[model samples]
Target: MTIKEKINKFISEKKITHAEIGRGLNTSQQNVSRILGESGKVSLDFVVWLACEYPEIDLEKLIRDSDHVSIVRESPATYQKPRLKEKALEEIGAVLDKYM
Candidate 1:
């Protein structure tokens, strides 16, 4: 599944609301709705943030996208420090392993 589809499915299965996601992302519910809707662009930072926020979700798989079709939009130089991003991802994986 695509990253958006995986996220939408997770949200649906978990009963998470757009309002809750908006609150977490410090964005508007409408914006969250748009982000999850068709034609909405899902940013790379958003994916990392979502994975960190919801560690139970299999982010590695979502990101890897075995079929290689989903293209996560990147915020220009968002993660200036690649190591920092790596660390966060490692932590997310550790958390997922521990919990799931």
Candidate 2:
């Protein structure tokens, strides 16, 4: 299913009017109507906002749109913090030292 189609289906299931969804997303009701009806496109940012807003919504289904998925990753690099704060440093160090 396309992304728009998925959203439309969910909207149907939720029995929510476009106005309500738009209100939740801080957009106009007519714009929401256009988005649902394929008269306008829903931006990736909007999709992200929707996902963040409705955490319980099935993302796999909700994000399935005709438009290609837009994955916005913050960063790929790893960051490290002292495990002492997590109180697992000793346990972690023991495992790592064993492997080494």
- Highest TM-score against the true fold, candidate: 1
> What C-alpha lDDT, on a 0 to 100 scale, does residue 8 get in candidate 2?
70
How far out, in Å, is residue 62 in model 2?
A: 3.8
TM-score of candidate 2 against the unseen true structure: 0.55
TM-score of each candidate structure, all chains considered together:
0.65, 0.55
Listed per model in order, the count of residue pairs whose N, CA or C atoms clash below 3 Å is 0, 6
What does the lDDT come to for candidate 1?
0.68
Task: Candidate 2: give the clashing pairs.
Answer: 2-64, 2-65, 2-66, 3-64, 3-65, 3-66
Off by over 4 Å in 2: 64-100
lDDT of each: 0.68, 0.55
Tell me the tens digit of each residue's lDDT in model 2 across 2-100: 767666766676677878777888889988887767577877556655555444444433443334333222343132333222223333344446554
The sequence of per-residue lDDT tens digits that candidate 1 reaches over residues 79-100 is 3354555755675576567656
Scored against the true structure, residue 20 in model 2 reaches a CA lDDT of 79
